[model samples]
Target chain A: MNRDPVETLLRQADWAAGPPSASRVDLADRVRRLARRRHRTQTAVRATAAAVVVIGVGLAVHSATLRHRLDDRTVALPPPPAASPSPEEVAQLRSQLAQLQKEANDLAARIRSMTAIQEQRERLARMERAVARLESGEEVRAQMERAAFTIVYQADRMDRELGLRESALRAYRQAIRLFPETPSAKVARDRLAEINTQGDRL
Target chain B: MVDMVNGPALALDGDPLPTEREDDGLVARLARGDQAAFDALVAAHQDRVSRLAYRLLGWSGDVDDVVQEVFLAAWKALPRFQGRSSVTTWLTRITINECRSLRRRWGRVLHREPAETGRVCSPAADSRMMNGETLGRVRRAVAALPVRHREVVVLHYLEQMPIGTVSDLLGVSANTVVVRLHRARAKLKNKLSDLMQE
Candidate 1:
């Protein structure tokens, strides 16, 4: 008997069928990284708030500190200079104000990036995971070999263009492990042999 | 939006599914702040959540954020989980609510995609039916479905949940679910009249 067509069609529309748990480790890493980034952002905001309060305490605190520093230096009474904040104190406050201002701008930029390219970043992640999934899935072996080598070749070319020799080497090695006897694997071996004069297996 | 944080718990007809029973235990451990239990909970249920999200939402958009939010919300709310509904059911409710919020935020309902931009271009991701003129209509029809009607269809027909079970999971009367299913199917048949003829 034919199965229900509606159900089958709907199942086919399952966009959520991700590559599976092999990517779970990567996902977990992303989740952790995102959570940590959020936490750091919050901590930074709190620090900025605290620094602002310190800046608000302003001249009295500066004058008091100046008095204390003088007292510590002389251990004898030299009357306090003026109630005015010394140039150094003003300079320190200005430096801190500048630092907090820079931090606020940096945080804004970060938050903007988080929102602005978020959709694009997620789409890229999906594509990456799709490749990772296809590489590991139980598709036809011959087709998989072809697909695997293409992926390796692209990765190799991109890494080399970016001057990432180590990454390109790693990619070829990984391709071999994942798709042994594939065309790319043989090519990778020949390439490695070219790098190493010894004829022994790399 | 379904009240995932607090509201009526989805009753499973006085009998929890086997996974729900397991969820009860996992909930207990989770409330105790067991990290492994947290990992187990995510591992077991994320796939279902992801599928529900895709069904309720559409083929486009960033689903990973939704999944991340669902699990994060579950973790934060687990301590208060009363075991009234299974964790999975609670998660489904949360997924629906999240999808609703997303639709509201985006000011658009689910829309099917054949050549949608930013979709990463994967034919393997598409069903053969999706490419057909009639079946493309079917995708639009299903995507056009109001999430309320879509909910019953996804939980009942797609998930193969029984009527009573679906009713309890949605916190609605069984008759209401039945009515929704009938309405949804009628709409589908109307939309895909040519396919129906075949």
Candidate 2:
């Protein structure tokens, strides 16, 4: 491509000449200042980042050690044993036992009275049977013995209800001995056999 | 028709340009933060950088500022230079880019001030042109060219960079540079035809 005229025109332009030597020196000094500033900034940033990392690591290690100590304290201890009762507690328990024994005796006496009332009802029923036997011209003595056996059986039931097992066995033996020929005596003997077997099991 | 020069050889202040090896060594030293090396580089290349900025940016007070910025950028970017292109070519590219940016940034103000707008006449040509009126007219005509065409003309004619170097600096193909130069010269010929007749 041809460029003679354009080059001539450009060469004729005085402003196209290079800058003076003094300006070059000044501009170089400015560049050096800028470079130094940039380097300092980079160094500050790196130092700050490193310090932050170190502090963060130190805190993490400290907290981990504290947590480890807490775990050790929690895992190392054994549980305490249960405490025994005091003398006052034992005395209070003894007094409660004596009061329970007295209540049981009173309940036994009330059951004995109820048994006696049942015996009285049996005697009245025997009397009614004697009257009935006399009116029918039957043996009244035999019916009276059967009524005695029934009273003894009812007494044994009352003894069993009061939790008096030995008394119930004695009453049943007495009923069988006093009226051996009566049907109620046979029932009493059978009850005595069953109670003996239960006692033997116990 | 203009004369066809063999290579785009610019003779600035009649001083010898640095060899390729010297430029490489200077760039290496600058990368290593050698302030003396940077000063030497500035002394060697500042003329070309400032002259390019002056022609591209016209007669402005900020030409010194642009030159400072160019060197500062060069110092910062020295580490990543990689020696792909000569340091002068790289600095020239940066100077052109900075000039273009300054133009766009202050375009409105520059457009309003006709006297302060582009004027490129040599100090020696002042006596020949009788007060530089004719040279000022030609300079204004060259500045009035479109930015792309004007860039090609300034780099090719004023800066005297070879077609390939201009291509490398502008990051365009050589054919594109030739075409832009052709269009710019045609426009300049038309604009200065009356001056030539005079």
Candidate 3:
């Protein structure tokens, strides 16, 4: 029978793939040991991964809370007083203002009193001059009285022209009392009687 | 030329071992930590991995160690079986890898245990055609082929893998597998020419 020599040769070698000599018991025991080791390793790895994930979540939550607290603190805090004055500074300014107000009031009172005293002093000096002129001589006294009555007549006339009836009446009476015999005094008495008649008519 | 004298090696090419659905089901059960499923898996593939390792390494002493390593690896990976190939093809890949690892441990040198065959036949010769002497000669001829060529012959002829499957297992093009098979056959032919005619 003719045959392909190589095919014949391969067929001859097929026994190399014969039934294995390894028993089922031996292989089973080895496979069992391998399975146990694999189980243990997988369990350890999973536990470690779960721990890592939990710790990561905890850290994230803690960080977020800390940030929120810091933000709240920032919002609650007052801003620095860059433009507005502080309480101490405000108190100092008010004290200075009060001191200035008191000084101003005192100065006004002083000026008013000084004005009254100056008026009194002027009246006293005028009386003293009148006395001095009366004591010098009768003729000089009459001349002085006439000069004073003339000045009074001029002021009364100006006062009457300027619509100061009361002032004019007072000036006229003063002239009559101080220089009763002078010519200006007679004129003053006539003007006074005329003003009195006019007042009575009103 | 279908010159099949032994039924088992040729039979594997025609007969399906387990379907993809069976593999998918097995993987699912194994993934769920099903101990019985793992046992069933080891029982099913142990013999095949053992035989393939024995042939590839050309040594019997190393076959059991290679087979156990293959199963231990399978028990771990069967749960994650991707269904890219059948469980049978996937297991065969593991068997080859383990065999290669063992050989590498010994610096890629395989000491052929004198061809021990009580079963198998040749077509051009008698049914029981010189089982010891002739088989030994063929085994030496195959082992003498280059590593790439030798694996194709062992897978395509002795292990009865489809060319495409052998190609996939070796991570090469089908054409490349075919080419290697051709070259391996030619070399074996040249080596066994005088013996086959005897």
Q: Give the whole-model CA lDDT for all candidates, comma-separated.
A: 0.61, 0.63, 0.63
Predict model 3's lDDT versus the native.
Answer: 0.63
Candidates' chain B TM-scores in the order shown: 0.77, 0.80, 0.79
A24 Cα displacement, candidate 2 (Å): 4.0
Expressed as tens digits, the lDDT of each residue in A4-107 for candidate 2 is: 66555555443322232123335677677757855765675566557556655665675576567546755665544533345675577568556655655665
Q: For candidate 1 chain A, which ten residues in a row score worst on lDDT?
A: A14-23
Residue B179, candidate 1: C-alpha displacement in angstroms: 2.6
- Per-residue lDDT over B1-198 for candidate 2, one digit per residue giving the tens place of the 0 to 100 score: 323333645543334566789988987887787879878989898867776676776433436678878888887787888777878778887888777777788772142222221122234333433134665667677778888888888777656667877787888988999999999888877877655422
When candidate 2 is compared with the true two-chain complex, its DockQ is: 0.10
**TM-scores for every predicted model:** 0.53, 0.50, 0.50
Global local distance difference test of model 1: 0.61
- Candidate topping TM-score: 1
Q: Write one digit per residue (lDDT tens) for candidate 1, span A1-202.
A: 4555555555534422221111143444455555665576668667666755665466457657767875665555355664454578669867866776676567567656655566576578668867866787623554546455544554444344334455556656667777787776887776666646543544
Give me candidate 1's TM-score against the actual structure: 0.53
Return the clash pairs for model 3, or none: none
Q: Fraction of true contacts kept, per model?
A: 0.09, 0.30, 0.42
Q: Which residue window of length 10 is worst by lDDT in model 2 chain A?
A: A15-24
